[model samples]
Target: MEIAPGIYSMTQRKGAYVHAFLLDDGDGLTLVDTLYDTDAHRVLAELDQIGKSVSDIKHIVMTHCHRSHLGGLALLKERSGAPVYAHQWEADLIAGERKQQPVAWRPYAPVRVWPLQIALNLGVARHPPATVDHFVQEGDQVGPLRVVACPGHSPGHLSFWWEQRRLLIAGDAICTWPSLMLGWRGFTLNPTQHRASVRRLAEFDSQILCVGHGEPLASDAAQAIRAALPSLDR
Candidate 1:
């Protein structure tokens, strides 16, 4: 779906949860958060939905190195030849130099659902190891995008800013699939940082929220996030 003028959000099931997004910066197609390799072709299909193709991808940015996000890297790189960019801390993880980080369990998780979310992330949220070509830090400018460091989901988790569109490309930093909510507690490394990340993201006051899952919030997006912050961990 079109999140704003030049941005789009696409969801491919990695069983039950986890998501990826695609951004068009008026120059070429840039993919953010690619689902598992199992869903690799889905990118080609999704691109086709917009009358684009794999070769059109000029750069691929993985929000973090989680397997769920890296799953499609190999094939996408093979086909598109676009450089994969990620945070410096996540570079090794993406390159298969380190083991994936495990989610921490928390009792007061914002969402109190049953084993469904767990089953999906553990059993289905997986992808092959891949390499990264670029390592980015906070305040980096990528085409029309501005890299915003919003960690805690992962040590180097990032969200992108489309200044002109007033849109936030929220990675696992926030999700809106079920409802306006913080990142799933289990997957987040630090609830405090995650909450802080949300707060930092809120400062942008973006009008469109292109989140990690569910549908994108097309309007008053920043208010929606700030509105939810009070309930998160203090």
Candidate 2:
């Protein structure tokens, strides 16, 4: 699952539920997302698959405040003694001090929406709070990558930009397949801002794209995103 020289892609069900990533920065391992608390074991297993151990993970970075993305964060942090990095806007949310806002319900939606709502209400995907050791902003260097402010999915939503590798860890900002979709509108806080973010991300001179819930792109990542941006309105 080594997508790049030092990058390993560890996904559960091809990220249908969630996906976490590991980067061997030569010094230590850096984890991208935590998936879910229940999936922490899977993370460990995946780490083993990549010839890395739990203790090797030096840091955990969150893309946004959604539960599915940060579910196993607390457990991972506790086990590895790694500091968690998040955006300042949602740092409190990750710290257990602030509660997440529920998705806005649209009347008479499709059948799929109901289950999504039920899960949220039941806190099914919610993760135990993990402390944020650092808050990142656009242009800040984070573990060999730069932060790209892609808010709209969440107040402090971010996408990691690895300029040297030309890889973009888009968080929920963009997803491939089923044709370049934006974050679920029901779950997103602002459609206008989301659209803007996606458009902005498409402009990156990237060759690979990684997301929280879809297959990763090996090449032509920016072209795919440009093609997919139009689908945002659909």
Candidate 3:
């Protein structure tokens, strides 16, 4: 689905409605996160729907190293020959050089995500590993996005801003599924960092909010984020 003028949203039912974005800036395509299918059939189908092909994708960027988001990365990179970008802290994990640091074993609220928490704690259901071609930091541009380092869910978790479109691709720093919250409580590695990061995200004048999980918020996005801020302290 084209959520914005040139941004396409692709979602997979598994992995907590894991969502990805495909951007067309009239300069080929840039993919943000690949849903939970290792084969990448869904992403490929989206490209087809948009009347594009894998060759049209010029950059493959990652928000973090979580399995739900990295599933199609390896296959997409090989087929498109697109350079993959991510934060340095997450590079080794993406490359399979190291395991992702686990989260707490104790379950948190919104019970639907408990299974995922268990899976992560056990290091089960790993994604196909792929090498990152470059490491991006805050203020760096990846295609049409301005990288915003949002660490909390993970040390290197990231979000992106498209100033021209007033769009915020907020990764897992915020979720709208099963009710909006700071993030999945059990999966957050550092609540202090996450809280601070979300505060920063809320500062943007985002008209459209695309998250790692759940449908995109097309209007009043910035206000919605602001409304959720107080909950972080609860």
State the TM-score for model 1.
0.88
lDDT of 3 by residue, 144-170 (tens): 999999999999999999999999999
Pick by TM-score: which candidate is best? 3
Per-residue error for 125 in candidate 1, Å, reads 6.0
RMSD of 2: 2.4
> For residues 95-135, could you state the per-residue lDDT of candidate 1 as single tens digits?
77776665643343445432534543454444566688888
Q: Can you rank all candidates by TM-score, best first?
A: 3, 2, 1
Cα TM-score of candidate 2: 0.89
> TM-scores of the models, in the given order?
0.88, 0.89, 0.98
Better of 1 and 2 by TM-score: 2
Backbone clashes in model 2: 0
In model 1, the clashing pairs are 37-71
Off by over 4 Å in 3: none
Task: Using lDDT as the measure, name the better of candidate 1 and candidate 3.
Answer: 3
Off by over 4 Å in 1: 106-126
